[model samples]
Target: MTKGEQTRRFIIKQSAELFNQHGYAGSSLSDITLATGIKKGGLYRHFASKDEIAVEAFNYACQIVGGKIEEAVQKGETSYDKLMAYFRVYEHAAESPPFIGGCPLLNTAVESDDSHPLLRSKAQESSGRTLDGIREIVEQGRASGEFRADVNAEALAMLTLSLLEGGIMLSRLEGSNRPMQLNIESYSSYLKQFCLK
Candidate 1:
């Protein structure tokens, strides 16, 4: 890529980290320029406005989270293990600096719900992608005879998404991992009942 394109990506990358830590509303153009050490003109040269950058930043953050989940899925020992790892991925993310403001999708969903329709749509899309991943896993497990044949892939998808997102919110809000830990523990038992021999 050209240097200009590379610089734009770099700005987006850095801005995404900052935006994930601070809400889009809380992240000003000045904050973007300062965090990225790029002047406002330079930022505008790449992104039209802070809202544009915020949108890109949210996309970048979701990419980071999705990458981590994919890595976890690949590292597992079996279909069941991979499904187990999929759930474990969130607990791991909750501890990472990238999730310092908690799940980016959840943060943006709450922050942009009433203000920015586009941003809210992006957040919803991020969640839809993750739920798609969960659905695919459930389908795989069913095909492989790891999960029960009657497993409702879409229902499991929604449950997994709700449990993980809710666990993250509760754990972060309470400043403790107990909620997450307990939730994940329950997840393991649920897996045992549905997926294990």
Candidate 2:
């Protein structure tokens, strides 16, 4: 890659955590400059504005978290195992989140809601992709006769995502992994209802 491209990536890598930890409005230009160790002029050279950088950083954060989820999902042989593996990735989110701050989708959705249109749109797209993936997994399980034929893949996928996100939020707020653990246990039990004996 060219030096300019490398520099832009470096800026995104460093600024990703900042944006994840602090919302677009909460994260100031000075904070980004400090995090990236790039002067304001240098930043402006790479990004047209802080909004552009924030968008890139949010994307970067999502990629990091998404990569981890993909890796875990790939390790499982069965659809149910794959779904469990996806949940396991966030089992210790309060202590060791996939990304620096937490789930990028959750953080961005909460912070960008009705405030930052661009970021809100990105979050919406990312979340839709996640739900689609989970739904696909459930559909596959049903096709394979692993899950019951009558399983509502869409509803189950939404429920899984909601439980996982809510677990992460509660665990982080309480500074413990108990909430996530409980969520995982509850979800696992619930998932069994859709399984074929």
Candidate 3:
């Protein structure tokens, strides 16, 4: 990649962690510069404004989720297993960074609101992609006869995200894993229902 592309990517990568951990509003350009060891002027060379960098950070955050989902489905014996495996993998990764932020989608949703127009759009787009992925997995399960044809794939996708994200929020706020594990168990039970013959 060109130097300009590399710098842009670096800025986004550094900012993703910062914005996810500290929030977009709380993260200043100086924090980014200090973390990256790049000067403020250097950061501006790649991003026009902090808002632009925030948008890019949101995309980077979304990409990590995309990669995790892709990895989770690699070894499933069947479509049903694949769907469940995706959630299970995410459950384990929940303690890891990014996910521990209680989901980039929820984070950005509450943080961006309608104020950060570009960041809000990024959050919306990322969520749409995640929903599409879950639906695709469910569609595959139906094709394999592992899931009922009557199931609402779209609704299930939304539910999966809701359970996981909501659980994370409660867990983070309480600074405990009890809430998270409870939601994981609940989510797994719902997945089991889909696996019924």
Ranking of all predicted structures according to TM-score, beginning with the best and ending with the worst = 2, 1, 3
Model 3, span 68-156: residue lDDT tens? 76777777777666666655654543455335365778789888896788878888888888788888988888887878878888898
Candidate models: Cα lDDT each: 0.80, 0.89, 0.77
Q: Candidate 1 overall Cα lDDT vs. reference?
A: 0.80
Clashes of each: 0, 0, 0
Q: How many Å off is the CA of 34 in candidate 3?
A: 1.5
TM-score, candidate 3, is 0.88
Sequence-dependent TM-score of model 1: 0.91
RMSD to native for every prediction? 1.8, 0.9, 2.1
The candidate with the higher lDDT, 2 or 3, is 2
Residues 117-148, model 2: lDDT tens digits: 99899999999999999999999999998899
lDDT of 2: 0.89
| TM-score of each model, in listed order | 0.91, 0.97, 0.88
